[model samples]
Every structure is written in C-alpha cells, then in structure tokens.
Target: MEQLLASDALSDSGKIMLGGAVVGLIFGYCAQQSRFCLRSACIEFWGGQLGPKLAVWLAVFGTALLATQALLANGGLNPQDVRQLATVGSLSGAIVGGLLFGVGMILARGCASRLLVLSATGNARALIAGLVVTVAAQASLSGVLSPLREALNRLWVVGPSTRDMAQHLPDGTGLALGVGCVALAGALAWRNRVAVRTTATAAGVGLAVGLGWAFTAALSRVSFEPVTVGSVTFTGPSADTLMALIVRPDVVPSFGIGLVPGVFAGSLAATLVHREFRLQGFDAGTGTVRYLVGAVLMGFGGMAAGGCAVGAGVTGGSVLSLTAWVALLSMWIGAGAAGLLLERAEAIGRRETAQL
Candidate 1:
C-alpha cells in the first residue's frame, strides 16, 4: 500500500476511492450470494423461525466482529482514529433514528444496502425506493429535514471517551466478545443446516467489512491530506453519490463516492453470472405508498442515527461503538414491533374480507 501510494499514478483521494470500490465489490458480491439482510434476520428472529436468514445474518455479524477486533488487537488498525469512536455521538439519535430506520426498512422490504443490491438485479421497485431514500437522506443532511435531525441529535450526547466501548472493557475483552459471537453464530448455522457455500459467502461479507476498515486506516496513515477512516456503509454514501451525480458533477472522488457504484457493479455481475437477473416492478400486493414512505423514513432515520443497518450495525458495532450498539439493538426492537403490527393488520384485513 505504501509503495502504491508513493507512485504518482493516482492522487491519494483517487487511491482511497479505488480501495473503497474494491471493498464495496467484495461486500456486494458476498451480500448478494449469501442473501445477507438485517431486515430478513430481524423478521426471522421475531417470527420465531431462526432459519437460514437468521443464520446468514449471524454468520456475517460474528465474522465481522471477529475480524475487526483481530485487526485492532494486532495493531493493524487504530480504533481511536475511527470516526465512530473519535467523535461525539448522540444516544437519543441512535434510539429514535434506529427505530425509524428499522420500521422503514421493514416497510420498504429492504434496508439501504439490500435495496442497492436488488436494484442491480433489475428490481425497478427497489431502484425507485433507493432513489427516494437518497433524496430523503440528502434532505435530512442539509435540506429542510436537517433541522429536525439536529434537534434529535441534541437530545442526548456523549463524548469520545464514553463512545468507545473498548475504553470501558477489560483488556482483551473485545477480542473475547468477538470470539464468543463467532462461536454462537457457528452453532446456530450448524443447527439451522445452513449450506457451506452460503456460510462461506456470508464470511466473505464480514471479510469485506474488515478489509474496508484496514484499507481506509492504512490510507489515512500515509496520505498527506486528511482522509476519513471508515468501512462499508450505504446511507451516507448513497446520498453523497446521488448528490455528486446531480448537484456536484465535478465533485472530487472519495471512498463513499466510489463505493456506491462498486456495490452496484458487483451485484450486477453476481446476478448475471447466477442467472438471477430479472426485471421486477410493483404489484398489487406491494403498495407503492408504503415503499415511498419507508424510503423517506430510512433516509431521515439513517442520517439522524449517523449510519444505516450495515453502516452502524455491522461496521460500527464491529468496532464496539456504544452508540452503534444501541442503534443496532433499537433497530431490532423497532423492526420486531413493526413486523407484529403489519401481521395484525394483514390478519384484520383477511377477516374483514371474509366477513364481507
């Protein structure tokens, strides 16, 4: 990496963007192949059917945790330099925003990353929903909705000292936590009889997360200009990518800017190779308004929370960010609640139809 950066072939920012693209490609391919999705995982958990969906999610999460912690333990990466730990965070935002994001993902039938993958596979509905999410996210970031997001963020704040979970834990406890999660995930996967190929792909997703961290951290260390050290995340990247396309055509290349296209390309390649590419649109069973509303909520909620499911949940959680963990738990709770409400509503509709 040092050797490559020393060469004048590309600018530092360009190289960072390329690294991001590589990580995003791996993430996209693995996520697509494994069908890794938090929304599915949440539903499976809440529905009391810990099947392949939940197993896949666990595999991704556990592996990500283990790999990231291993990197930190070995001094391959510095936790203090990372944004999730280095800066102040909002507990209130994590709770409220996570809940909103969870409910939104449920309504949209997918989270930000899932929607992007689906869009690449020619899912028109997902494509539209993703656009809406980007628009809403942009609005929350700097437009009208920014005020509301700011207000919520101010409700409860924590400093860098408290934000980093590693600071409070006993020495090596982070590594132990990672190991325990991996063991649990392995056991669950075995119990569920998840396929070996599926498990491998899921692990690949986790690998991508680790690689993302390593790439950025390494780049930041060597770069003359300041570079943010981050891993795989979709919400902020999606919004940034969209804005670059429409608002700032000449925007300088960044990691997030490259990540969006990389994921799309990887997903497209996977779907094409597997013969899974199919054009899909909205049907009567899938209402448009629900998806639109969900996209809006996800946009605002993700911004408010500082990241999306894969963003804060897997990436941030892997690094042991307090707010990220809180956000992840809140997401689960919100998703479970939303799922139950949806089920009841469907049941009521069925009964009413029968009576009529």
Candidate 2:
C-alpha cells in the first residue's frame, strides 16, 4: 500500500477506492454464489427450519469473526480509530433501528446487499427497491428524516470507552468467541448437509470482509491523508454512491463510492457466467407497496442503527462493539416477530379464500 501510494500512478483516494472495489468484487461474487442473505437466514431460523440458508449465514458470520479476530490478534490491524469504537453510539437507535431494518428486510425480501446482487441479475423489483432504500438512507443522513434519527439517537448514548466490548471482557475472549462461532457454524453446516462448494463460497464472504478491514487499515497507516477503516457495508455507501452520481458527479472518489459499482459489476459477472441472468418484475405475490414501505424503513432504520445487516451485524460485531451486538440481537428478535406475523396473516388470508 505504501509503495502504491508512493507511486504517482493514482492519487491516495483512488488507491483506497480501488482497494475497496477489489474487496467489493470478491464479496459480491461470493455472496451471489452462496446465496448468502441475512433475511433468508432470519426466516429460516424463525420458521424453525434451520436449513441451508441459515447454514450459509453462519458460515459467513463465523468465518468473518475468526478472520478478523486473527488479524487483530496478530497486530496486523488496529481498529481503535474505527468509527464503531471511536465515537459515541446510541443504544436506543440500535434497538429501534435494528427492529425496523429486520422487518423491512422481510417485507422487501432482501437486505441492501441482497437487493444490489439481485439487481445485477436483472431483477427490476430489486432495482426499484434498492433505489428507494438509497433515497431513504440519504434522507435519514441529511435530509427529511435526519431530525427524527437525531432525536432517537439522543435517547440513549454510550461513550467510546464503553462501546468496545473487548474493554470489558477477558484478554482472549474475542478469540474464544470467534472459535466458538466457527465451531457452531461447522456443526450446522454439517447437519444441514450444505454442499462443500457452497459452504466454502459462503466463508469467502467473511474472508472478503476481513480483507476489506486489512486493506483500509494498512492504507490508513501509510497514507498521508486520513482514511476511514471499515469493511463491507451498504446503507451509507449506497446513498453516497447515488448522490455522487446524480448531485455531484465530480465528487472526490472514496472507498464507499467505488464499492457500490464494484459489487454490481461483480454480481453481474457471476450471473452471466452462471447463466442466472434473467429479467424479473413485480408480481401479485410481491406487492409493490410492501417493498416501497420496506425500503423506507430500511433506509431510516439502517442509518439510525449506525449500520445495516452486513455493516453493524457482521463487520461491527466482528470488532465486538457493544451497540453492534445489541443491534444484531434486536434484528433477530424483530425478524422473528415479523416472520411470525407475516405467516399468520398469510394463513388467515388462505382461510378466507377457502371459505369464499
């Protein structure tokens, strides 16, 4: 990284953006191939059918935890300066925003990352929903919804000292947690009979996340200009990428700016190679209103929570952030609740149709 920065080929920001694009590409390809999605995992867990979807999610999560912890343990990465640990956080925002994001993913049938992958495969529904999510996220960030987000964020706050879970735990606790998660993931994958290739691919998603952190951290250490150290995230990045294209075409390139298009291009390549490219649109089973509302919820909720599924749930969780863990648990609770409600509603509708 230092050598690349020393070269006059590209600017410092450009190098960071290129690094992000590489990580995003790997993430996109692996996620698409493995069908890795938190929404599907949530549904599988809540529905009492811990099938392939849950297995895949665990593979990604456990691997991510293991790899990230390994990097930190080896002194290859220092996340003290990362936003999740360095800044004040909101417990109320994590709880409320997590719940909203969980429910929104259910209604939308995908999270931010999933929507982007599907859009690349020519899913018009996902394309539309993704756009709405971007708009909503932008609004939450600096537009109409900012005031509400700020209010909720102020309801409960925690300082940086208390934010990092490692501070309160034993020295080896992070490694222990990572190992335990990996073991559980392995057991689940074995029990579910997930294919070897699929499980490996899912693990690649986690590895890509670790690589994202490593790349940024390494660059930050050597670069003259300040650079944020973060991994794979979609909510804020999606909004930033969209705004850069529309409102400020000349906006300075950043990691987030490159990540969005990189994911799309990677997913597109995967679909093309796998012969999964197909144009799709909304149908009666997939109501348009539900998706629009869900996108709005996800946008506001993700911002309030300080991250989305992959953002707070995986990346921040890997670093053992208190609020990130809280948000993840809240997301699970919300997803489970929303799943049951939807099932009951569908059952009632079926009964009514039968009676008629």
Candidate 3:
C-alpha cells in the first residue's frame, strides 16, 4: 500500500514532465492529422507546388518567433542563460552535417518526428528505425562514436558563439521578427487562402511550437532545478528518453525527454480516433536495409549539425540564427541534389529497358 501510494505521487520534475507531455500530445495530434513533413515540404518546393504546406511551415516559424520574443520581453526567460538557445558549431559543420542529414531524410522517407508518428500508427519499420536512431544518437553523443563526433567537430576553427537572435542582432531583432512575420502572413494569405482542416491544424502546430518554447522558459525560470528551454526537436530527445527508460538516470526527466514518449502516445490516440491505425513494415530486405542506413545517418548527421529538421529548420530558424539558416539552406540543396540524382538514375534505367 505504501509503495503504491508513493508511486502515485508526482514530484516537481514529474509535474514538468506532465506539462511537456501535454505539449507533445498537441504537437503529435496536429502533426499526424495535418500530415506535416519537412521532407514533403522540401519535395513540394522542388516540384513547384509549394502551397498550403509551405504556408504552414512559414506560419510555424513566424508564430514561434513572435511568441518566443514575447516571452523574452516579458521576462519569461533569459536567452543567454538557456543552454539550448546557443548555437554550438561552426559554418562548416552546419553545412556538411545538414547535407548529410537531408540525404538521409530522403532515404528514410521521413524525418525524426515523422518516424515517431509512423511508429505510433503501426509502422514496424519506423519503430525499428526509431530504435536505430536512439542507439546511434547515443553513440555519437557519448558512447563509442563520441570520439568520431569530437574529431569532426574539431575540424573547423572554434569561434565565438551567439545565444539567440536578440543577442546576435541586438539592434535589429524586432525588425527581423517583424519582417519574418509579415512575409509568412503574406504567404499564407496569398498562397494558402483556403480555410481547410489542414490550415487549422497548421495553425495549431505553430501555436503549440511557440507554446513549447514558452512553457519550458517559464518553468525553467521558476524552478530551482535546472531545465532546458527549447521547442520541438527529436534527435537528442530520442536518446534522452531511451536512456531514462532503460538506464533509470538519477535526474528527473526534462521537457524533451517527457515530450518524446508523449508524442508517441498522442500519435497513437490520434490514429485510433481517426481509425487510421494500420500495421506497416518493410515489404522486402532492401527496404529494411534502406531504413537502417537512413536512421544511422540521421542520428550522426543530426548531432553533427546540432539539430534535425525541426531543430534547425523550424526552432532555430524561427530565432533568426545565421547558423540555423545556413544549415537549413544546405539541407534544402542536399535534398534537391539527391532527388535529381534519383530521378536521373530512374530515367537512365527506363532508357536502358527500352533499348533491351
């Protein structure tokens, strides 16, 4: 009875975890229902059909930027002190790592977050891929592969790092945010004019992403314990959650850690509600091999780049960090290059078959 009672009680860390879980739940539902995928976004842009989905992407960045800035202005958080707010690596690292990640993403057919959603919705391949990602991320972060990651990190000249946009562009932070907000709004109005379910879902996701930053920031400010202020990003948190579950660490679960499983649960609930739950797995050995390779690459590349699509593409990009922007562009170019190569190979194969 005593053991049961004790287990039922929630600690301060547990409370924070609960809040993070709620945030993740919203994100998962919105993402699943809306079919949000950074890979799809990139593909659409390449195909010249960048419409509603692209608008949603812009909206996420715009909303996150505005909301985060509001938190900063209202004393909800201190950007300089927050560990996650800082950009870690140099330009060379960002470009190279992002290129690798983008290529890996194409091979995987999804990004980190997408894998989680697919896993919850009965995709066995995504589950395996997720496990691989967790293991590889851990290896790169602190396990045997740490040495390789460190070596690559050291390849470039270590320079001064900036915390966030406000600090980086002290004089033009407001202007930057304003310009970004206007552009995103204009895009949504002009290109995504139709008010569909996807639009609402996108808006919800944008708000949730912003709220994620605010929620973490607010809690970190009042809590006696240390916490990281961040929005959504799946790479590091996948490893963190896996460690917490298997290793039973001394520390309480952070927002990112809690959000990891929450996303799965939320995605599961959403799929169930929508009656879209279906078991999916690799149809052949080649599919298994492809997913494994992609997962490993994404894990290492994401760590090297300091983020995945959401981390650098949405979260960091929203903050107007130059490193994030550079990484995002590199990812775009890499995905485009891979796509073109694949197309050319297919065309060549078709031509050869015709000759035969």
Candidate 4:
C-alpha cells in the first residue's frame, strides 16, 4: 500500500510521517485504555498472575513479530535494511543498561511510552519525568556523558557480526519464531480474558504494533530518499524530537518524530472520550525524588542499551534479534528484582508502623 503511495502528490517524508502518526494514535489509544506497561507486566508476572496487561504485551510483541516477518518473507522489507543494533559491547550494555532502565521505570511509575500518555492526560509528574528523560538522553548521546558512553563502547562493545540472529539462524527460523510466538500469545490471552473490553484493547494494541512495522517497511521500500526502516520505538525518537525543538532546526521530521506527538494526541483524545482526563501531580517529595532519579537513569540506560523496552523488546525482538532478546530478558529480571525490593520495603514499613 505504501509502495503505491510513492507516486502520490505527498512527498516520501510526508507519507512516512503520516503513517507514523496513524500508528502512534492507534497505539496511544489502546495503551491508555489497556494500561499497557512492560514494567507492570514484569511485576505481575513475578507475582504469579498472568495479568491482562502482560498478556496484552505478549500479544502485542508477538503480533509485531508475525506481521514484520511476513513482510520480510514477501520481500516487502529487507532484513539487511532493517535497523540492526547488535554489537560486541551490546551484551554488557543491554544487561547493565536494561537493568538501569527497568529500575528507573519502576521509580518513574512508567516507561517512556507510558510517560508520554500520562503527560498527555495532564499528569504533571509524568510531564516532568518526560522532560528529564529528554534532557538526560541528550546528555548521554552527545553532551556531558558522551565520554562515559564512549568508554563503555570501547571496553565492552562486541564486533557487529558476532551476535546477529538473522545470520546464525536458518532460513525459516524468523518465520517460525514469529508465527509460533504470536499464535501462542494470542491463545493464552484469549484463554485468560477477564473482561471483554480489556481483551479487545489488548488485541487492538497488538494489531497497531504490527501495522506500525508494516507501514514503515512499506515506506522504506518505496521512498527515494533515505527512510529509516523501523517501527514504533520511543527513546531515540523522544531524544531526537527534543533536540529538534531546541537546537537543530535542520532536523527533518521522520516517522519517529511524528509518532511521538501522535501518541500524546491520541492519548489525550482517548482520555477525553473516556472521561479519565484529570490534572495529576506528586503527592510527596519522595515520589518527586524517585521520578527525577528514574528519568536520569532511563535516559542514560536507554541510550546505552541502544533501545528502550518497547524498542528492543518488541520491535527488535519481532525479527528475533539476539541483542533485543538479551535486553528484553535483562529488563524483565531487573523489573522483577526491583518489584521484589519495593515489596519487601513496603512490608517492613508496615511492620514498623504496627509495632509503633
């Protein structure tokens, strides 16, 4: 469909941006309605309830895998052209950085995508966290923290060809992974449906993610100018959007750029329709401190990992990328550990209060 649009009156960039915005809108609406958060999913998984949110996430990720791989099989997208982030240093980065990102997400009470949705619905804390994440991301990428990033790269970065999943896997592996994962996730989600509305919302979110990949892949194939062959991932795009706003006027609007704002717009619209829109802020200084630190850690950690939860976990993992799998697993472990720590602390505090 996007290939057919190549000759349309709109420029290639415009088409790309349009596709991104539409996908973002769909995702935002679904996420807001479903309360989809990867951190929450990890915590819930740890708690032993296959929560609706986790089911939704698996379904969403699996949907992306199936959709994207189908495109690759049909030659609609080139695996070579896909954004591959595997490197020698990535192993350490994904584990260490993913842990940091997971912990920060717990502190902030949301990941990058969830924060954007929260900000749209007039959550002041989320707004502040978003701003901090944007700045911290900039600092890590090119500002003060670049040296630290460079040091890590020099010390731990692996050769590019070492962990490339596509190269090592056989011809039919990508297809098998995608199909099997999606089918299994969808079946489990269906069996566990607690509410019809939540189930529908989860399915919608999954479809939106798949469509996002399809849209980008199609555009990349047809565009004459350089187009990023990627789908929905928030960290780099959030940082890039911030930089574009403040310093770089020359930066052209890409799919990620359009997608970020579209998420806000879509979430806002959904909240209004659902009557869930309300101004919210921190109730305590402790929360404020936690969010501040979390934002900083997330900014640096996300960049180090080469992606955030959604970026590496869903989009990259769709193609069975090794770096993404490692990062995703690391994030799960990190979030699980953080959740346990928090729970233990809360339990101790309760005991202390009872004794007092």
Candidate 5:
C-alpha cells in the first residue's frame, strides 16, 4: 500500500487507479442501490417528501477537499499538476456549460453518473445520453469544439495554483480543514435528512460516497503511478474513458473505472444485486431532439468549463476548488431555471387536463 503513492514508480499510479476503480465500483453499486443523486433530489423531491440528496454530494465535495488537501500538505501528492488545478477559469464555459448541462440532464432524465448506473439497469435513455455525450465530448475535446474551448481557457485569469493550497497549507491545518468540512457537510446533510425523516438511508448514502472517495485517495497515494486522492466526477474522465476505449484500450487503468465501461459495470452490478436492470431508452413520446440538444450542451459546456456539475459539483467541489465553486453555483442557477420551467409546464398540463 505504501508503494502505491510513491512518485518514483509508475506502477504505483496503476495500483492507485486500480484501487480507485474498486472504490468506484463500490460507489457505483451503492449509489445505484441508494439512488443517490443531488440533481435527482433537487429536481424530483417534492414538498413533504424526500429531502434534497445534497448530503451525499456535499459529503463527496467536502471529503475530496479535506483529504486531497492533507495529501498535498504532507507531500504525498502534487496538487499543482492535478487536472483540478490545471483549469483556467472560464465564466462563459461554466455558465453556458452548466445551463446546457442542466437542460440536457432534465431531458435525459439524469446526469452523467446517473446515466451510467441507470443504463446498466436497462434504462435506454441513459444509454442514449452516454452515446451522445461520447460523440459530442470527442468533438469538444479534440474536434470542432476544440478551438472554441481552448479560446475560452485562454480567456481566463490563470491563477498561480490557487488550486494548490493543500501543498502550501500545513498538514495539520489541511487535514483539519478537510475533516472539518466533511463534518460540516455531514451535519447539514444530517439535519436535512432528519428533517425529511430519511436519516438512516441518507447516512448510508453519504457514508458510501465519502468513504469511497477517502478509500480511493488512500489507494492512489500508496499506488506507484502519479496518484491524487479523488472521487467521482463525470465530465472529463467520462469523456477520456470514452475516447480511450476506442483509441488506447491498453493504456493502463489509472484511478477509477473509465467512464464508458464504468457506467455499464456499476449499473450492471447494481441491477444484478437488485434484479432491476432492463433496457430503457426508446420513448417516442419524449422528443429525441430535445434530449440530443441538451446532451450537446453538456458535452460542449463540460469541455469549455472543464467539468459538468458532477465533475465540478461533487468531485471538484470535494476539493473546494474555487472554480468548482463557481461551476456548481452556476449550475444551480441553470438547474433551477430548468427545474422551474419543468414545474410550470407540468402545472399547465394538469390545469389543461382538468379543464378538459
């Protein structure tokens, strides 16, 4: 385990990634079973119903911040080089990206991670989203959208690794900060869960996500290759995983299940345990055009802004990356807009049906 985090060996990185994949598997299974999703909670939870699934996400964000900070402070990893810090802030990317993502998720009926896990359970909608995202992501990553995304990246003020505070902060402070934030997020989540009376379930959900991330971080540190303690996020990694599947299938598996495969694996594992996996994506009732349009936004926005809500919201948020904060906050605005619109549409339809 100690050898896993060593900078001297590439094998360590692979070990860390493998460990991460295991943690991800657990996360996927647990998440699938629990149906944990911030957006789902936010979008689906009604008054006097389930509480916002914010805790699971908050736990992930909080833990990612604290643990990664501790690792960097202790000289276990280089925060500067981590992709989280490498991003150049892009307001347009974050906002436009988020709005597009928010809309797409609504139409697709889930976010990227949700799509992955759900697809495994036989939800064809998710499978469609996954396929569309992969193609759009490729375009955004290295195709027609590449130049546009680069232009946006260059537009931002490249901070001197404000993304690397864990490296600068004392190990103790960073550790306490990391642990404390998780604690804070936990408290808030607990209060919400209790309020909603889903205490037991929420705790389990939050625990699975937090522990999964922590486990991965520990594994990444001990593994040989370049490792950074991290957890779930669906934007870049999902895209990379998708592209890699086609381009470099043999490239060493790093930290987590690459996006394309992980979605199926995690969802399948969930389905088998629960016996709920079924193929779901062909509804003529819901416009495919609407879904595809939304997906395009997610891919382009994810690339331009550096991540989607899951990537920025949960994963990057875990690191407390300022940019992640920007992205998440922006996403809420977009999500709220879309959610509100959907609510209005539903209300109008109900009224019309009543009159008829």
Candidate 6:
C-alpha cells in the first residue's frame, strides 16, 4: 500500500511518509504565521490601505527567482519537464480568467491563496469556497469540464509549454532577469518595511515554500512513486488536493502529492499552537451572493488561466516561461478592471439608494 512513498535516498516507503510529514509541517507552520495570501496581496494593495501586501509578494518573488536560478545552474533540477507547470501562453485566457477570478475573490473576501490562509483561521465562507474550488477543479481536470478545457486549450494554443520558454534564454540571462525583477520587488517592499513585518516575513516564508516543493519534486523523480510537483497555491490546488486525499488512500500519495495536505496541516498546527484558531461564520446578505458567485467564477478562471497567481505567476514564472509572464500580466490587468468595476457598482448602488 505504501510502496511508492519511499524517499529518493532509499526506496524505503516509510521514508516517503516521513519526508512528506516534515515538509508539510514546515510549510503549514510558516504559511500560517506569515499569512501568505497572493490574492490578499493584490486586492489589499489595490483596494485597501495595506502597503505591505505588495512587499510581501515581491520578496517571495525575488527569493524564488534567485533560488530557482541557482538550483538550475548548479545542476539541481529542471523545472520545465514537470507537467504541473505547463507553459501555454494564452493572453486572452489569462486576462479574462483573472478578471473573473478577481471579481470572485472580492466577493469571497479572498483570492485562492487568501482562502487557504483564512480557512486555516476557520472562516466558514472560505471553507465553502474551498469546497466549490475542489469539486469544480476536479471536473476540469478529468470530470465534466476536462474535455472542454482540453479542446479549448488546444484550439487556443499559441506557443510552446511554459517550461520551454526558459530554455530560449541563456541560464545567466534568465538568472539576471529574475534577480532584476526581485530587486524591483524589493524596492516596492522597502516602502512598507516599517509597516507590516508580517507581510515581509511572508515573503521569506514563500521562498521556503518554493524550495520545499522543488525538493519534493526532485525526490519524486528518484523516489519510489514519482510525482509531478510545483508551488502549492490555494485556488486550483485546493480542489486538486481534496481529490488526491480521497483517491490517494486506495492509491498512493507521492512526495509532491503529500505537500499540499502538509500545507493545510502546517497552517492548522500553527493556529492551534498559537491559540489563533478562530471559528468563522458567514453572514446572509449580498455578501453571500458575492462569495458564491465569485467562487464559481474563480473556479472557472483558475482553470481557464491554468493556475492562480501563485501557481502561474510565481512557480511557472520562475522558470522564465513566456506564458507565465503573459498570464501574470494579464491577471494584474484583469484584477485592475475588477477593482474599477467594484467601485462603479458601489457608486451606482449608492446613487440609486439616495434617489429612492
């Protein structure tokens, strides 16, 4: 039953389970404390007065860049062949998908990444979002929507896989580009340095996360049951993880396969130890409608865009995929649109109410 779970060093299945546990614990603990939420970063920076959100995101962006580049240069591992980070540049899909997801996130009170963090804190609405995300994600992967997704992807397919984009550039050039991007991110974070240390810490934690996944990915190849691996994001991965938990028991949880549950467990444990586990309940109002509707849109957008910001932007982008870059840009643009739309809706509603 546990045959495929062994660590790469030894084909011993027990080691696999142990490896997963250790990785998962670290991931969960840091994520919880740091409150790493990609959606929150975008939304808060744009809508709220939170300055650290961008800093936190940029810090991780830089760290992942330096680490991934160094790893590849030193012959650590190749990120492209991993199917989890497929490179398919569809500009329209990303912008459109991100807009839908962004609006959904606004309604749900979080993006895919934020949902996970909030869920760890016991938010009921997040739990609902998670449930919908998982079911719908599965449907996209292999259920009802799988065929359609595949068909559309093929139809709109414009370029090589994301991983292949990295190959187009020299290693040094790639490394430099990543570093420059991170520097820019660091500059952004500098402004908020005195404000949200938690957000800054989040950046470091996100790096740890990227490394953890990379190792798990490498181990999967040399280990007993090889598993495809990439950065763990809450949106699509939430649904994917749920499906894995249900099926992997009769099946097997590979090294990379186990990290996600580890992420949630990590967060849960942090909540418990820190005495921060808070029960959450949702209110019945337009808020409810917003969350539900947003969740559905997020589900569709996450699938359509291929992954969330953390998934497509950070993980896939690190490898220097053109598709990832395109997706990332498109997402931010869409998110901008969502922000404007929300403002307009509010203004219109207030006007109508005042007239009444």
Backbone collision count in every prediction? 0, 0, 0, 5, 23, 6
Measured by C-alpha RMSD in angstroms, how accurate is candidate 5?
Answer: 4.6
Which residue pairs of candidate 4 clash? 88-157, 88-158, 89-156, 89-157, 89-158
Mind giving the per-residue lDDT tens digits that candidate 3 earns over 1-356?
12221343665477567767887898888888877777777787787876765666665556666765666677665666544455355566677778878887777888888898889999988888888888888898999888887777677633335535456567657546745764765566477673566666755666677777777776666666776678787889888888887898574677787788888988899999999999987785446777888888788877877788877777776655666677788888877777777678879989999999
Cα shift from native, residue 205, model 4 (Å)? 2.8
Residue-level lDDT tens digits of model 4 in 1-356:
44536557778888887778888898889888877789778887999987666777776676677777777778876766666533353677777778888888988888888899899898999999988988888898899987886666455555546556777778878778766765676676777764667666756666776777777777766678788778888888899888888988776869888888888888999999999999988895456988999898888878877788888878777766677788788888888888899899989999999999
Q: Which is the winner by lDDT between candidate 1 and candidate 5? A: 1
Which segments of model 6 are wrong by more than 4 Å?
Answer: 1-21, 44-50, 84-95, 158-163, 194-200, 234-237, 244-251
By the lDDT metric, which is better: model 4 or model 6? 4
Mind giving the per-residue lDDT tens digits that candidate 2 earns over 75-155? Answer: 877857678998999999999999999999899999999999899999999999999999999999999999999999999
Which lDDT tens digits does candidate 1 get at residues 1-356?
45555668988988988887888888888899999999999999999987788888888888888889988989878978989999999999999999999999999999999999999999999999999999999999999999999999999999999999999999888778777767777788899888888899999998899888888888888888899999999999999999888988597788888888999999999999999999999999899999999999899989988899999999999999999999999899989999999999999999999999
Query: What is the Å distance of residue 216 in model 4 from its true position?
Result: 2.8
TM-score of each: 0.98, 0.97, 0.87, 0.91, 0.77, 0.83
Instruction: Give candidate 6's TM-score.
Output: 0.83
Ranking of predictions according to TM-score: 1, 2, 4, 3, 6, 5
TM-score of model number 4: 0.91
Writing each residue's lDDT as its tens digit, candidate 5 over 280-304 gives: 6667777788777767777776676
Model 3 residue pairs with clashes: none
Q: Total clashes, candidate 2?
A: 0
- Give the Å error, residue 279, model 4: 1.7
* Residue 139's lDDT in candidate 6: 79
| Per-model lDDT | 0.91, 0.89, 0.73, 0.79, 0.62, 0.64
Model 6 CA lDDT for position 262? 69
Report the CA-based lDDT of candidate 2 relative to the real structure: 0.89
Candidate 4: segments with Cα more than 4 A from true spot: 1-4, 85-89, 249-251
